[model samples]
Target: MVNLLPIIKQTLLITFFVMSMMLIIEYLNVFTKGLWSKGIEKSKWKQVLLGAFLGVTPGCLGAYTAVSLFIHDIIGNGALVATMIATSGDEAFMMFTLFPEKAILLNVVIFTIAIAAGWLTDRFFKKKFYIPASDKHFHVHEIPECTGFPKNTFWHQLKHITPTRALMLMSILFFVTFITLDEHLASGSFHGILKWGHSSHSDSDPLWIKITFFTVISLSTAVIFIVNDHFLEKHLWGHIIKRHFSKIFLWTFFTLLLIALLMKHFDLHSVIQHNMFWVLVAAVLIGIIPESGPHLIFVMLFASGNLPLSILLASSIVQDGHGSLPLLAESRRSFIIVKLLNMAVGFSIGLAGLALGI
Candidate 1:
């Protein structure tokens, strides 16, 4: 029973971070009107290179931006494939944060593979869009909301707190407080709660950078309180915070908790050490998970010298960060097909690397 406390704290801690991230990304997605990738879809290689560049940018933004473009018919299937291949997911940022040199090297390789694979997918699929918005099966919830400043004074606007704004404010405040308290209590005890290796950005640099960043973000939620009804409900609340935060928070918590429980009972590192097949299989299987957070396991294992380069490469190739989330939300069929292709690529590369001793 006592073991449960740290687990809960850690889970909630990660949930808070995930929630904050969703809030920011979703807000930006709404802010940009989802048309940021409009002018780049003119040529085949142009689209592929654009996707690769976006994918290699080191966050969900790249993938999400790709999804936005694809949904609007601004990019095609090949570009979509390229983006996913290039995207290292959220784990890319963490890897870069932890070991910049290795992550950068892996990213360069990924970028190269992504460009080639994207072009191949384009040639073979021979389609403009894998699952176009017109396809009866693939649907995106289109909420077209306009934004402009309201004609109210600042103090008067401060008095206006919608349910969503209040909720956002409270969540931000709770996370800020949690971070502040965690820093003071970070011993090896359960109260220290954070699973350093299990989470992202575990570099020696003062984790205080994270705290301060979130602190500024928490303060920024005041915008929610003051923004007019249209911007609040349509842009901030409906488009981003309400739509994404809860889902991301839930996924983050469950993935973390499940990984924690599994690691506790199973010696995964030992299980994979003697068996090349199991290592490759596990790498590809975990890669199939659509979310970016879970891949941190393979990364931390690699960083600790417990996992091999080839296996890590397999995971890196197969995983698409959060790039798949919009696809999963749009068309499960397309998402499944993409994952299958990536699995094949990952296995071939992983096995070939193992054979060549590379």
Candidate 2:
């Protein structure tokens, strides 16, 4: 139990950041009336650019939104390809937590590649890969009430809060309080509070990360306070929490625990060093799994200096997380095409990077 304490703390930190990010994105999407999704149907270039932009965002929400647009025929196949190509699924959240600078650079590269690949895909396969007529029309549930704020005062809403709103508000407040306490204890800013069963630890995140978490959590607290039941229930709790929370938490916890155990038990770094080429291949192959949880191993490996940038990039390029699962269901042909293109791009980049010893 004592040995697991650090891993548990790290897992919670990562999960909090990931959840906060998703909440902010959901709020923006609803508040903007899905504005970022509009005008995307006007041009192929626009579709590709918008797709890449959304894909680079740190969660599967963007991919889901893009898939919704694609199935509706609002965006073309190329746009879907770009979105999947650029998206790293939920692993992106972990990447941001573990190696933010490299994660940023990786996303930029994925964005660029996604744009070019999307453009070329449309140019060549425009006729080859059309949205099947059956899947061409589907409905995305939209809460009309979520499009704008209610006219009621914040205090009034709080006074009349529903179960969902109350739960979200209390949860956000608890997280905020916990984060503040952790920061203070880690920094020894309030040493007198140590007797409260909390340790003054040295595992504090970097200053920028601390600031980022504080700022985002504060914004989230405000969001919880302001959003009406419709938005809180339908978007935040219903979508973000229900769909994402458990998966992110479990993946992070188990991945951290497995890594910890492996390091403790064996010479894992040496094994990886001896089979770097095979490891890169495995990374690209694992990227095909479609789920975000599998690729996290590569992200963690890269963060710990046991894996190369090439392998991480390759895995990222090939995997769309669970983002493509809907596409698989809606249109198997389109899903296959996207995966084929992704594998090609991922493998080429992996080999090139290896040959150049990057």
Per-candidate TM equals: 0.70, 0.87
- Write one digit per residue (lDDT tens) for candidate 1, span 69-183: 7777777787888888777776664465335567778889888988988888888987554546474534333422337555574556557656776777787777667756775
Off by over 4 Å in 2: 40-42, 135-145, 180-205
Give the residue spans of candidate 1 off by over 4 A: 53-73, 87-109, 123-137, 141-146, 149-155, 183-212, 215-228, 234-251, 258-266, 286-313, 320-337, 348-358
**299: Cα error in model 1, Å:** 6.2
lDDT of 1: 0.67
Collision count for each candidate, in order: 1, 1
- Give the CA lDDT, 0 to 100, for residue 198 in model 1: 53
- Please report how far candidate 2 places residue 29 from its true position, in Å: 1.8
**Model 2 lDDT tens row, 264-349:** 77677888878978998888788889787988888777766667788888999999988888777877887888898999999888
Query: What RMSD value applies to candidate 1?
Result: 5.3
- What pairs collide in candidate 1? 89-321
